[model samples]
Target chain A: MSEKLKRFASNNKQLLIMIGVIAVVFIILSLTVPSFATIRNLTNLLQMIAPIAVMACGATYVLVIGGMDISNPSVMAASAVFGVYCMTTLGVNLVLGTIIIILTGAFLGLINGFAIAKLKMVPMVVTLSMMTIGTGLATILSGTRGLPRLPDSFSEFFNKTAVIIILLAVMLIMDFILTRTKFGRKLYYIGNNARTTKVSGIDSESIIMLTYVISGVCAGIAGVINTASIGTARANMGPQSQILDIISAAVIGGVSTSGGSGRVRDAVLGAFLVCGLTNVMNLLNVSDYYTTLIKGGIIIGAMGIASFRQQQAAKKGV
Target chain B: MKRILAIVLALVMVFALVACGQQAAPAGGSNQSTSQQGSAGSPKQDIAEAAPAEKPAETELKHVKMGLAMQSLQAAAFHAWADYLAYRLDYEAEQRGYEVELVTLNADNDVTKQATDIRDLIAQGCEVIFCPCLDSQAILSSVKEVHDAGLIYVSYCREVSHDAQGDEVPDLTVNFASEEQAYAGMVDLFNIMKEDGVEPVKLIDCYGDKTDENAHNREHGLRRAMEEFGYADLPVVEVECGHWEPDVCGQNLAPVLAANPDANCMYSSSDFLNSGIQKAMEDAGMWHKHGEEGHVYFSASDMYPLGIQHLREGYMDTAVDQGCYNFAVHAAAGAFDLLEGKEVEPVQLVLGTQATYKDIEEILATIPLWGNDYADY
Candidate 1:
């Protein structure tokens, strides 16, 4: 057991700590709220988290590689609006519209990747600028008023359990790409030390670009799900939603801003952590203003704990 | 030289005739200037109607321009309101021959941008400014500046206050009557439901942002209905979901449903929020029970075609139709009256209608009243 502990501490301490915290929180919350344990409630919870979870996984990759992707939500908004426009105004098939939206997201992601990797712009500034551009374009494409009149069948996708399953599948695939494949290995290497990775014949630029593309695709999917979930595609829907919550989720879920050290699974868990906390807070009838303050405090607490753990790891040279 | 002398002599004669006429007139005897006396038989009224009268040759009349700023055109209902207001002002100004020109500004919901936009508008010498403010009141220091400039200023949707001499009146009143619109709608909604013989209705009341007077009024209106409709003893499950966002409404409804699973009726502040509740109920497969009892239903304050459509489709019960376009028209009319020296009531106007699914289809046919033209943009 000692040997296993040492091995786990060496490779998976953050993951283990994340799981433990989630379990403790879940157990405590379930004990307190009986409805928290129900399958219907849990399923509903999973559906709530899946879209953002998938997006967070992509954001995890961006953070792991020393970049930020604030552009995701705006890109998501633009794609969702386009998809709705196609589905309604242009009279296209839902599947085709979905594809177009996904492609639009991927295309913007490509732009973000190229600018950050090739142009060597600061990730924060670049993504923030893209956020503005993407949002403006979304409003223009959506005709200032939002793309409404979406078909009932189009929204059915979000209400069913299939959405959660799909997000999970995507997460698994992303996990495979980040761990099993040669490209995945190169991503970790590039994230850890770009100069070293380059000297070792890895094209770090390509990997970074690809990561942004993944982020974009994730954002597109998130947008579509969001549209389906809300039954409307307003460009500035939840204007502060991305910055106020997504960053906290990523940082608290163990995705390091220092880069080169996190898992997609960790990010997914973090997304669920936020959703679960929000659910519990609502059940407790916490005011939205206080809910925000509490959420901010929780993220700060998580970050503090993670930093403390890192200090200990460094002291032990683990 | 001779022709120039004759022209000068004719001008002097005309000036002498005007001076003698002015000297002969009693104080306050006539309101019309000599330049306005071109015709005697109502032809002056015809001239005012047919032609853009040349400005009195004096260049000293200070041009008092006012800026109209908006948050966004994202909601179709809000768009209709904005367009109607703009159209009324422009059309009336053209008819009335006023020197007033409206500068339209769209902020797209950015609070920071709205502040800067107001500042820019102020810098352009806007004497009177009207804003449908987006949250964040401190951002409206520019409004105070405009007021300090002695410009007539009012917020269209939200009221602003001034430091008065121990008397508190609305500093800058909004156009819509927040209390009446909300109270009338909810009262009508409950009256319709009660008329349908839905006795002892258990209400799950939900509303929008508490910060908004419109939303606050909607909440109190529901409270009033419960009190007035003899359902004062009926149980109520209350929640505030902030925006008219459908998902927020749905999420808010989830817990309310859990807390009061047997609630016979649900009341919402906005049609959009009501739609969210409907969506949540439908998803839970408990929607049928709402109709089966002829008691379980959703009611809201602001009405839209979608709400009416949902009602007809057996998804909603009743909604209070606050004709937003009417509100816009009345606001524009007031602005015109202020510009043209026509007497208008200083009090806010409350415009509304009450309709069931059976009657709303007729409302939808008059597209110009509620349709999108995108002209304001």
Candidate 2:
């Protein structure tokens, strides 16, 4: 048993370090902050982390392929707005509306993918343009208004419990695709060296395109879940800050911004840490300015530690 | 298969950590009221029956926790109001000899974040919560949660949906007559422009984001003023929408200025956006000071610091202040009143003020503008 534990630790040294950091934060917040240790707080923090996690999880695939997607939040808002507008205004069924949301995100993702792969466009530029287009398309689709009064049954069925279940399923799917699939293995190869990966008989373009498609599907799921949770649909639900927050979650989870080294598991942990810190800070009555600074410090701290670990591993010739 | 097992193990370990960290609330009592009455009836009526007839003894002063959840601190108007509220809360707490802990949270303009912020406030054991909500309709579900937790909810500035009983969800609301502030500003602008021997020929309407209900209200105010002042037929060269971003406002204005060189007058929904509009106009060479050859008649709502400086310098013609300072005063009052179980108004209107370039000195000296507090900005 001791040897098995040691092997597990060696294999997941980075994840274990993150777990340790989270555990420390949890203990300190519980000890110092009022109402931070309660079941309600924990549950609330866990429930809200799902929307962020879904996007961050999908983002892990693209990050592993050495690509950036700043368009996830915009995709979420656009898809949710379109889906809800169809249901509320056009008298479409709720389930159909939900499907439409995901498909719309996928469609937009296809556009982004085709441009980046077939047209040989830069991922950052293509996604940034998609981001602007998505936000604009959402505003036009919703007629620059918020659609409210969702069916009670729809919202009622998609409450807090649904958040956890949805996130769990998404994490499982992403983990399977990343760790258990042949295509998933190729993403890392492409990230490490695209020319080498292409020469090695991998359809690197298709693999990259597929990664974006997965990202879009995740954003769609995030949209439906968020709209249902709030019971309202506006064009810009979470807006640009949410995109940055999603990226921050991935980076904090130790997902390499330059690509090729991360997991959905790590991103999930990062999501929890980000959400938990926000929840605790709100409860502790910290000012928003300080909260912003502290959040920056955590991201920087996480990246700095990861860099140090990489340097140490390199020195040891690992 | 081993990877699947490892994934399962990781999840279990995480859940175990969550279970290990779970603990109980502190010894202090939560602020959830036992009485789950309607908002209109709950605070004002209950306070009448329940509050002490007079001030309690110094030692008997009640300790209360409160929360102020803002949409964002991006806008100068929000910053001014929040700052003034923070200051006034301390002053009132000292005067009333009560202990008050106010936690101010900014949602960064995200409805999802704002909803979570509201939930966090509820979790923090706050008795009274003040929010100028992002989307009033969207926040209804969280409003239900707030009441379910039996806390007093006070909405600031904007009106929200009513409860099942047809009463508003907010236990109390400090509301502004949304259309009136911009209408007053427009009216003042038109009348003062006529006095100065300037007629609004071709006009431009720079407005706020369409997603905001308040922005639509400002649009209605501007149009109503146009119809009433006999300028409805005046051809508007451009109607630019700035999503409350200064750079967006400036960029939107630049092309419109170039496209319509004949445009002579402008109305902005929010004066906070005028800096961008100002820069855009300067780029177009149409930003000449008042009494100069190419000065445009400018009118806007909200007395932010930039508006104050422009009106003083004769670059801007008119501004209607949202009375954010007074709004803060009333909102702070309603917060403490609800906490102390004192009778509070169900809905109170905070009136707006109009300032013209001609009266900048007098108005700045005589009136309390939230912008005055941020003159250095």
Number of the predicted model whose TM-score against the real structure is largest = 2
List, residue by residue over A147-229, the lDDT tens digit for candidate 1: 55455576576553778877888889987788788887787777778899889988899889999998999988887776665
- Once fitted onto the true fold, the runs of candidate 1 whose alpha carbons sit more than 4 angstroms away are A1-10, A314-316, B1-377
Q: Cα deviation in Å at residue B21, candidate 2?
A: 21
RMSD in Å for candidate 2, one decimal?
7.5
Distance from true location, Cα of A41 in model 2, Å: 1.4
Tens-place lDDT digits, model 2, residues B151-235: 9888876666543223237888886666787788888888977887888888888876665656777888888988999988988
- Worst ten in a row by lDDT for model 1 chain A: A281-290
For model 1, how does the per-residue alpha-carbon lDDT over B241-320 read when each residue is reduced to its tens digit? Answer: 64456787788778777667778777777775655776777665557533474346666666655565566565565655
What is the i-RMS of every prediction?
33.1, 8.3
